[model samples]
Target chain A: MSTDTAPAPGAAPPASDERLREVSRVSRLLSRPELGAVVGAVLVWVFFAIVAYDNNFVSWATTAAIFNRAAPLGILAIAVALLMIGGEFDLSIGSIVGFAGMTIMVLSFPSDGGGFGWSLWPAILAALIVALAIGWFNGFLVITTKLPSFIITLATLFIFRGLTIALTRLRTNRTQLGNLDEVEGFALADTLFASQFEIFGARFRVAILWWIGLALVATWVLLRTRQGNWIFGAGGDANAARSVGVPVNKVKIALFMTTAFAGFLVALIQAVQFTGADTLRGFQQEFEAIIAVVVGGTLLTGGYGSAIGALFGALIFAMVQQGIIITGVDGDWFQVFVGTVLVVAVIFNNFVRQKAAQR
Target chain B: MSGNGTPLLEIQNVSKYFGSVIALEDVSAFVRAGEVTCLLGDNGAGKSTLIKVLSGVHKPTKGKYFFDGKEYNFSSPRDALELGIATVYQDLAMIPLMSVWRNFFLGSEPTKGWGPFRSYDSEFAKRTTKEEMAKMGIDIRDPDQTVGTLSGGERQSVAIARAVYFGAKVLILDEPTAALGVKQAGVVLKYILQARNRGIGVIFITHNPHHAYPVADHFVILRRGMVYGDYTKAELPLEQLVQMMAGGADLEVLQHELEQASREGGEEAEALAETAQAIESELDELEEKGND
Candidate 1:
């Protein structure tokens, strides 16, 4: 009889060079979930640049304008992307913008008509705290009740929106809060939120820098940190994540708070930039942010996405918005363009996902 | 192997009750280091309940659980993991879309920096994942490859290796080879042996007797939430193990009835007699082999 012992541990041969090369080729392409966003961004930019070339769409001023407009949306989109990657959503983010803006306005309006007349910095801080609390409440409700975040945040969206309108009407006797520019410390807040800078003879808002900084930090967190792994795990398969010792609930709660914090930042920027706040300041921003995130290559179902992709998505949005205006096309067509881009991007994302799973 | 020392893990008279329903009643098993304890049972045989009790998913209503010669109670799976007990569920707890290394170090990632600036040590993770998998005799072509691309057997190997690498003193595998084909099941069986060789107390739960008989040092047959029989490999032969797993006395009585019916002499009875005779000869051969 032949004596055949089990193969020794670690006895398998190493992968051949040919196999390595084949694997690397597939992995290299599949590694970047943001590739679709990059291609979409380039295609949109080229299309806009070519279509609106005669209208100075490619000029530095127009480019700066696109960046300026994209900043707040990009900031919110980054947070939305993070939340989505952690397998959650914050539909109340739009309501938070309006609520935070109104908070800053009413507290720092410097008017006798039911206003607190506080300094701008204190008002901003108070608004930020309120936003954080709302986020905490949303997270707690979703976690403790074990309900879908989509439904939970959808309810909060209407609740907060109503609260914003009621508070604005009760305080100002109108749907708007004004006199923000006359508040003490308005200039200080403006210097950080609404300040303008000239680069290559083009003016750009300070919000652009904040957007870039936030994106860089988010990208780092997504790719380089333990928390990033938890986010991916929680989104990909929460039960599995918990089985492996990931604090899935904690990661999700933090993501919700982060999204609210992002909403507060956008509200502060807009309040300072416009010198006032309207009850409808952030109308539909939640949907828009989700759209941008989806366009950036984050899955609607969660667990796969990139912050850099969201940034590009925001840029594409801003380009289409401003490009249409510059090209003298009907502004209503902007929504049509967004709808088309979303569908096309989703199809492209599916194609890329299938390719990545090809093995 | 078991009597040489105290078992690495021992569950004594464990009983679990789900409200009014009795899921498991007075089950007992012990796993020794460097031995494979095969828990054999078919579906609805309280195998899952026993596994849950061992893995700390449920606190036994009555019974003492001892580990490393000390009695303790586990409040959660996390607590069990902290105490060096890792359970690889049938699902494997792996994210399919994630890379093999990422799945390998899902929750317990290695970090490389200080305080707030800390980052995932990707290099260490990839290298360790490769080395650990190789220890289980799996040569992964790329650590960056997603876990979904691996075959079912390879995925099970990855989970097993991950448990061992993470310092599991006792490894509980839940139907790991249930979905695999013959070749794949053999591959997983080999890995179980590998784990056992490393002195890990392996509690392998499966309904397949063929898979268990070859690798098991001790077999504990579970039937309807109670222990039917427990025997060491030397004391109990493979044929008896199969018979016990298939319900020993009941199956024999059924065979005798079939033989009696065949003696009545009809076409159907003749066919039944042929089948009964075939089964008897197979058992005879198995008994002869056992006697040898």
Candidate 2:
């Protein structure tokens, strides 16, 4: 952007390192996409620590509780961030949770009561397949019609939510199911998805491991793989990616499936823990997951973000939601607090992107 | 490296129609290894349409495409790529948010090890990208810098260097200099020659004859979706190429319009009139030369 660097026309520029200084060290730090999310997570933690000083908010038990609450949302956030970076959306994820949970519950019910009483692992497998199919169909529709994923997935959200209720009611005459722990192989599913383990002198659900594992994998794929490159390319400029011979459609569709897979994981974890799921169990979670992603420093517009940032984004959400209770602040103001954080994060992310572009 | 004067990629009688809109009609051109073929055209002169056809983004509605003397029609961009034809689009097809190394090995990334552990070779990719960039006379201090941070000329050089690295026999650069400053445009033109020197067939497309004249070995002028003129560097001098680019005799009508507008009775208008007269005289000299 400066004149000294602009070599005179017709005079070939010699390959000299001293002639061009691209970015300063300080400016590079300021340009990181996840810087805002990390800073916000710290500030939110500090605020809770001071306000709830007299409460158990600082305890390892409460810490474990925060992890428990954040785990499911974190799983969803990582997947959502990937899809957002790949330049698509999945509004039907919350409904996928309900649908998958219902599939497991209905299939595993006792045979005498008009149920197949299928083994727990088989039911879970079937549910996963259904969820993946939904994801593939969502991606297929979005690609084939060239319509915005928001509209296509919004329509799917309603359609699948209705199916969950109608299909579950037809199976058991009730919109909710429970006592799936009685099925064969239930012990293994519960041990994997719902069991509590003592870590750092506090009991934590196994879902936390899943969340942490997913965050690490998503980070690895985003930073250390070719799929990550294609993801960014497809989101940044689809036509450009296509012209450059990138398989843009395959990347996007796979990302959609990834989001569905995350939703299924959360549903499986929750179902095994509670022994049940209602039709509206995962309702409004789509919005919460997106909020966590945005507050984690991901752009809703796509093509730029970090999965580790989403990890912090989910942490911030859990802290505010759980810490508000310990602080004795009106829990009703939780949304207000989260909403404010979201807007600020977006403004900051935009600023960082501009600063990075300028650098 | 096939510099035996054989066409590596050629298209004949290519016509593309998008539901009655004639984007390109009867456009024919060929490029040979170790030679720069310049396709000169104005906006909407089927330059982009022809590029899309060559790169296999769009199948020509009517025509024949040949690769190394073998008649073929490409159905996808990947097909063109497998045949060693790479196109560096005007926008460069780069993800600005991504790092330079990542953009360099975007679609065809080099990977290592077996399944699950099969990962993109970042150390190799970064080292290769930096080394290739340096070979292009661009000292990229950091291969990790986001491509958006690089100047237009540097970006164009990266695209060219990547093509050369991947062994593209026919490099189709679509308006690589259109978005750069004059200094940067000159820099990119140098890179075009650099690619050509690597025994690669270069198809350089531009609307500016000045940019085209210095680097192009052969010239094909396109106008209104058709081939207006085709000449070798030995046959087409710079002035004659400029004249042919401006649709002969059409320069007179534009000169008349400028003279009519110069009647606004101001010093700036007088300057405009003077410049217009210089252009008219240059056209006149080209006509006299054509007669000789």
Root-mean-square deviation per candidate: 6.6, 6.4
Considering every candidate listed, which one attains the maximal TM-score? 1
**Model 1, span A124-186: residue lDDT tens:** 999999999999899999999999999999999999999999988888788877667888888
Instruction: Compose the digit string of candidate 2's lDDT tens values, residues B42-83.
Output: 988989988889888899999999989999878788888878
Candidate 2: CAPRI quality band: acceptable
- TM-score (2 decimals) of chain A in model 2: 0.92
- Score chain B of candidate 1 by TM-score: 0.85
Candidate 2 has an fnat equal to 0.47
User: Please, what is the whole-model Cα lDDT of each candidate in the order they appear?
Assistant: 0.87, 0.84
- Candidate 1: misplaced stretches above 4 Å? A1-18, A22-27, B1-3, B249-292
Candidate 2, A151: how far from true, in Å?
A: 0.9
